[model samples]
Target: MEKKSMKGYIYLMPALIVILLFTAYPLIRAFLMSFYEDYNMISGEYSRIGLGNYKDLFGDKDFTKALRNTSIYVVFVVPCSIALSLLIAVLLNSNIKCQGLFQTIFFLPYVTSVIAIGLVWSWIFNSNYGLLNIILSWFGIDKVQWLNKPKYALPSLIIFSVWKSMAFDILIFLAGLQTIPKDLYNASRVDSTPRWRVFWKITVPGIAPMISYAFIMGFISAFKVYNEVFSLWGGKAGPANSAITVVYYIYDKFYNSHNYGLASAAAVILFLIILVLTIVQRMMGRKK
Candidate 1:
């Protein structure tokens, strides 16, 4: 037994080393750096250990805006995407024809490159000679500048995020739906229960865990929204930086401005926020 355990540890050594080097080391280093003042990346020197970085980050208008935009994005995208995905998943899980084709079509965005999708969506949202504007013309609505205007930038990002996020969510919901016993559904049909009542009483309760899972995953993903903004706006945050998120702020600070201490502080704060939210979600899920 001792020999077998030793051999098992030997096999796990490579993966453990990789995790320690890549994941654990970075997290620890970032946390430490967040407390450092006037830290030099090249020299690895700091004037002192303090909360100056955090204080400055909180005072900065750009950081505050990024936080607000990220919060709004999380609040909107998570619920909307999950609800839409659940509805579509329920419909597709039914005895619908061409289920495979529909599922494939819905999932294409997940597999496709975000850069490519963003480019396509850019054309769709174009103010002039765009598909969306052309559709709106039929309703006699004036053209709206989606990408060009600051006011509409976050909304455009939200819309794109919702569509992209649904792919994995719908897939998970479909899998969850399949796990629900068919006997319950059959019994509902035999009792001649109203479709709406059946859905509310049976289908929803059956997939409660999946819904919870989706919400947790959705919130985490939405909070770290940077790449979507990058792809959509061609590496810019948005017009006048209206759509800047927490990650974007960190990137700007660390790379563009070369403010390592401030960036680390912001990154640590983002990590803490995510950690707290995840814990709260788990507690709520347990209670439910």
Candidate 2:
């Protein structure tokens, strides 16, 4: 037994070493750097150690905007994505023709590159000569500047995010739906239960756990939004920084402005926000 345990530990050593070096070290280093006032990466020097970086971050309008935008994005995206995905998954799980094909089409976005998908969405959202504008024109609606205008940037981002995020949620929901015993559905059908009521009472309760999981994971990912903004705006946050997120703010401070201390502080704040939200989500799930 001891020999077997030693061999198992030996097999895990490489992965443990990699995690320590890459994940643990950087996390600890970032936390420490967040407290170092006026930290210089090249010189490894700081004027003092306190909450100066955090104080400055809150004082900065850009950081506050980023935080607000991130909060909005998460709040909108998580629910929208989950709801849409749940509906689609329920449909796809039903006995229908071309089910496999539909599933493949829906799941394609999950595997496709975000940049590639963003570029396609950009063309669709273009103010002039765009598919969306053309469709709206038929209904007598004027052209709307989705990408160029600051007012619409966050909405546009939310739309794209909800669409992009639905793929994974749909996949998870479909898997959960499959695990549900067919007998329950058959009994519902024999009793001639209304489809909507059956869905609410039976299907929903059956997949309640998957819904909770999706919401928890969705919130965590949505809080760290950066790639969608970058891809949609071509490496920019948004017009007038309307769609700026905490991750984007951190990147700007760390790389563009070379404000390592502020960036680290922002990263730490983001980590805490996600951690607290996740804990809350789990507690809610347990109570339910």
For each candidate in turn, the TM-score is 0.95, 0.95
Write the residue-wise lDDT of candidate 1 on 70-160 in tens digits: 9999999999999999899999999999999999999988998888888888888899988989999999999999999999999999999
Residue-wise lDDT of candidate 2 within 142-170, one digit each (tens)?
99999999999999999998988999999
lDDT of 2: 0.92
Q: Which 10 consecutive residues of model 2 have the lowest summed lDDT?
A: 1-10
Weakest ten-residue segment in model 1 by summed lDDT = 1-10
User: Can you give the lDDT of residue 10 in candidate 2?
Assistant: 88
